[model samples]
Target: MSSEVWFTVLVLLVGVERLAELVVSKRNAAWSFERGGVETGLGHFPAMVVLHTGLLVGALAEVWLLRPEPPSVLAWSMLALVVASQALRWWCIATLGPRWNTRVIVVPGLAPVAAGPYRWLSHPNYVAVVVEGVALPLVGGAWFTAIVFTLLNAALLRVRIRVENQALAGLAA
Candidate 1:
């Protein structure tokens, strides 16, 4: 198979993985809501969804349109980063357990989680997200998609982190 075919398969697998995450997230959201979790950052939620979906779609589109042939070294390195990011993302989810969801929802009176990836960085999942944003597209030699997603994700993360912190603060209060 051509590199483009392989790249398409990889992107499709990632999309399936994302679907799995949404399933987990939806269940977790319900768990939080049942426990009186208050959700913040509603306004940005749609944008987040759109941007992420765009990442997958844009990567596929760019790869096929441009038909870039990245060096084997660059492709392999980006692929490694993509895998690592997925691992880190799942680590965050497992650490948070039922508390982990796509949206920022905090149950009152519960202390913030300080275990797992959180032990090192406050928002380790975003680190995974940032890495994947750049690496996934480049794995398929889609540099334009990588650059655009990275910039947009950075702006979105800025707002997301602020809202999440405030929600966590409310939990502490």
Candidate 2:
């Protein structure tokens, strides 16, 4: 199989990984909500879902239809970034543990995490997200997909980070 085919498979695997995360997220969300967690940013949740799903679809579509040539150097670099992004995302999840839900469900009276990546960055998970959003598409030579997703993700993260900060306001302080 060609790299293109492998890239498509990787994209599909990412979709599956997301579905699995949702399962964990749902359980965590329930646990948090049970402990009087208040969720903010309900409005953007659906848009996030759509945008993430569209990323996979757009990546595949671009690869299948356009077949852009992925330069070896760029492809490897992007692929490394993708792997690093996944590592960072998992680190964020593990660091947060049950407090890490896909939604912004904050259980008040509890402290915000400030270790690991959180020690260095306010929103380290978003760093992973941004890198993956751009790198994943580029792995398949989907420049258009990368560009569009990066722009939209940027817009979404602006709202998301603000909402998250509000939700966790004073916890880390």
Question: What TM-score fits each model?
Answer: 0.98, 0.96
lDDT of 1 by residue, 57-144 (tens): 9999999999999999999999999999999999999999999999998888789999998999999999999999999999989999
Clash counts for the predictions, in order: 0, 0
Looking at model 1, the pairs that clash are none
Which residue ranges in model 1 land beyond 4 Å of their true spot?
A: none
Task: Give the worst 10-residue stretch by lDDT in candidate 2.
Answer: 164-173
What are the C-alpha RMSDs, in order, of all predicted structures?
0.6, 1.1
- Model 2: number of backbone collisions: 0
Can you write out model 2's per-residue Cα lDDT over 74-130, one digit (the tens) per residue?
989999999999999999999999999899999888998899899999999999999
Residue 130 of candidate 2: its Cα lDDT?
Answer: 100
